[model samples]
Target: MKIKLFFLLFVSIFSNAQVVINEIDPDTPSTDVKEFIELHSNIPNFSLNGYVVVLFNAGSTSPYSGTASYYAIDLDGYTTDANGNFLIGNSQVSPTPALDLPETTLQNGPDAIALYLANGSDFPIGTLATSTNLVHAIAYSNTSTTQPTALMNALNLTVCINENATSNAANHSIQRKADGTFEVKVPTPGMNNDGSGIVFNYLTTTFNNTSYTEGQNVIITFTTSSNVTSPVTFTISLNNGNFNASDYSGNTIITIPAGTNTASTTITLVDDSLDEGDEEFILYISGLPVEVVASNNSILRRVEDNDYQISNFGTPLAPTYGNVTPTIPTGYYASLEGLSGSALKQAIQDIIANPAVVHLHSYADIWDIIRTADQNPANHSKVWCMYIEQPMSKIDQQQGSSIVGKWNREHIFCQSRGGFQVALGDTADGISIWNTTSAANVVDGISDAHHIRVENGQENSSRNNKNYGTVNSSTVYAGPTGTQGSWKGDVARSLFYMAVRFNGLNVVNGDPSEYNGSVPSGNIGDLATLLAWNAQDPRDDFEMNRNNYIYTWQQNRNPFIDYPLLANYVFGPQYGQPWFASLANSILNTDEIKIFPNPASEYIFISGIETPTRILIYTLSGQKVLQQELSTDGKISLNLPAGIYFVNMKSEEKTETKKIIVK
Candidate 1:
């Protein structure tokens, strides 16, 4: 927003004008050169009544180079030509008959003259130049006893005047009434100097004179004045149930009061039940001793008066998995040739069912088979699976496009494949596949796999796509040239992609282009989702916990299934036993941690957690309040008024979080 301040009153008779010069060559002067300058003043009807002074100053040099010179031009009796150009007088020596130059010492070389107009209060139109009508100064340096180099320049001038006559007018003030109405002096035009200098004029229209309601009354008022007593008749116009403008016919005419020279009027409201938002009202007063108008409007709204409530989703259930116990089913992949069907099935099942199954590896056939099993009624909803696939050129060509290739790979061995789809209890609702196409693909794939079920399909051939001979020349053989090398590489790559996508954990470090076979970390849940059991076992694996619990129940004949509020006790706040506290302490002690307002009343400030660190603040009730990085000085201010809160801070090197109380 830009704002400008203007002075309304002044006693000085000097005229105010601004001039600008353009187009000047310091090296040479041209005869066709043009120059312009403008002049602005408050004199109502000004004419050329004096001379203009022009000064020239030369460019500066090493020590003290330039000098100043002045020239005076008689413009008092000058007349503008057809092109609005006028030559005052022919150039001569130091002084002319009608103009004179002040005595001043010259420094070094020729200096350009700065021009000033004397007695500019009476400058006539078409006589002095303006922004549109410019004046040109042409000059040339004299190398000999002859002519000097003609310097060409343009000058532009602007004139401003303060014709405000209300500077001495009687002060007119307005006050809003307690009843949400306005009381004004009737015939409001007698408040200023004939309203001549007033830019806007206002008058009241239809006076609603209505009373105000309890919750709906907002009013605004304005005042104006006149200096005469001709009985200014003012009419007010009512619009949108509000005062618009006042006029004799269509304008508000302020008539002088009967006995006094000043007149005043009161505008009141009868109805105030207007809706909240922006409401406008115009007050136009005319026919005042002088012409003037004033306007005022307002916006209204209802204040909110309510409290906030928190909705509860109830406590979570205890994890079904138990201690690191393995549960492998028999004859799971018996159909596959040369493969230990039971062992492979058990391994795959254990990989999928283990609460610590942070990562898994398999061929397309294995994935298809597992997906089919997951679709079975007995296994449905019991297993959640996600498959990450590599982007290959052969697959791209087979699917006609990379996007289509990815879609096919995701649904590979899906439940949709006839008998395999049905036998494995495969359904459209059960499988989710993440395909690595681009870096952004990982982000999107992670979002999609976060919540999806797994279904097994029996037909591995359809899912594998062995017909590579027709797609690419490099792959003349079925699948790949190498029997096990290519398959193993592809499986490892797929597993790496899955682990990274699922847990945001990057375990492998090597160039994919180099194809270096490197084994990744085998800590399953290192990047896997955690699951707890028994509320005290201190283990985090759903499948292991479930298998162990089942085995214990079967061997000991112990009915400990519903052991002392197991549901609440197992999933409650005390379940993990200060896991977050340990993590927090480790981070703070290792990273020069500092927290301000230790016993804060409203907020806790944190600093020095190192770069690229993630900070999370949660309430005692497990409600997250802050989650972001601690860049720069590593400072984080947690807003939690007067209460105990937990702070979880994590980085690539370590993860630590702690609890602090606010006042």
Candidate 2:
């Protein structure tokens, strides 16, 4: 009872004078072994009868809730020493704490160490903090931001001083100087501040290569000379570039957490398809500098875009074109007017490869392209498997996804063998520029969409770098997928187009060693077999459809698909023949002549055959009724009865039997 009465008298005497919280050691070189809290009074031998010290974890990841204080002390019988300083600390402290504490009793800051005049009601363990009796308090952290402004605001503390600043670093105490402001300083428990051990402050950002490729996720890091109070957040400043914050990280924020000197986040890039050359960028940090000197806070870095599709950067897709001829863009083929052989090939190459505009697609866009170009005729929703001649849905299994079925892009002209340049591949991400034929990669011939086809993953691995020609009697190896004739013609045409498009890349008669190097060079296949396949399979509607469709997005055509006869003029029997476009519908395509508007009433137009041939009408009974000479107009009048009749087209080269219905 006497003690309680003295506590009330002591609080009444000092309630206005207010005992101040002088120092606290929340962190130490060891497991907080010497951690402690000190209080001071203006009067020596001052009794702290009703005072209490409460520790809070409002800044920790998992904060202490109401009625759950980290630690508490009741000073019912405590008194300041002669110098008016009182200490509470671990047993290892120099001048032992008047009150003892267990090791690791403190948590790193972003916390509060508050003093209170408890009004004779001592706060014991498991009690909540109260503002009613509050006297003095200190809030601290080494991070830029902390939680619950309510807690600090409740105590009128708008700022959290750094306890781990450069001067104090770690294993030190935040002590109140004579001015009553706290600064992290060397331990001075039960004594006055000497200001020793304060060092230079630094918090810097370290950078690597400035120039990263469009799709590369370059890592950026921040370093500190001292440990941070907590996790710090900052944003990248795009000082000068053709981009915005959206181009940095989807949201453009990075983090450097506490207990560490460094932290990293990748600079998410846009892997686009425009074939742009090298681009330049500058990066730096912009945010509230956490416990760092202004000089050390700056970061001006120059990076080179020497180089994928990183996280959040989606691969772009080509635009769709309705059912149109997709005829050459105006003046697109004007340069190839009278040229043939190598000259024509060179002109074609130049027309398609307009380096000025930069024609190339991203390596990441292969899936979207191949799916559309190889769209299955039977099921428009599916892609035609290149080797197996089957339909594989666009939404089915994909290589990058580890799905074991469906399709991926194939280099008809193997990228390695053709010495084509493709960005490195991430097979698991459904991306591979290796054979995409993206026009953007037109210079190297790898990103060319014309040469990239829909091939199953198994076949892609099987055909790996092998020549396009027949291996042993056929491209049909002992598997479901192979270089079958249907696809062989497609493959040959792509190779031929590539050979013409890229200089130094060739198609020879014999098998060549597979090129597996950085530079583009050497030959690709058995030209003899490719030519034969070209003759055997010719260009079908599928090839025509893709040639026309791909042109809409890539802005170029595979001449081999457009003018089948170019093959003869350049590499076949009619090698060196001066070619013309009329030949596209003439003998160049005549190996398998087609009669348009058959079952007609007026007349029938013809192509793929030379003019001035004999045309005869014969009954199914094998009796020839009439004969006429083929005309300059290349059409024949059908004036017979409305019945099925056999027409014999007789050119000087050969004769073909055709059945027509004169409706």
Give lDDT tens digits, candidate 1, residues 353-373.
333322222223333333322
Model 1, residue 197: what's the lDDT? 29
Candidate 1, which segments miss by more than 4 Å at Cα? 1-227, 236-254, 258-262, 268-276, 291-663
The TM-scores of all predictions, comma-separated, are 0.21, 0.39
Model 1 per-residue lDDT at 527: 10
Error of 2 at 472 (Å): 1.6
Residue 43 lDDT (model 1): 40
Candidate 2's clash total is 24
For model 1 the TM-score comes to 0.21
Give the candidate number with the greatest lDDT. 2
Residue 312 of model 2 has an lDDT of 18
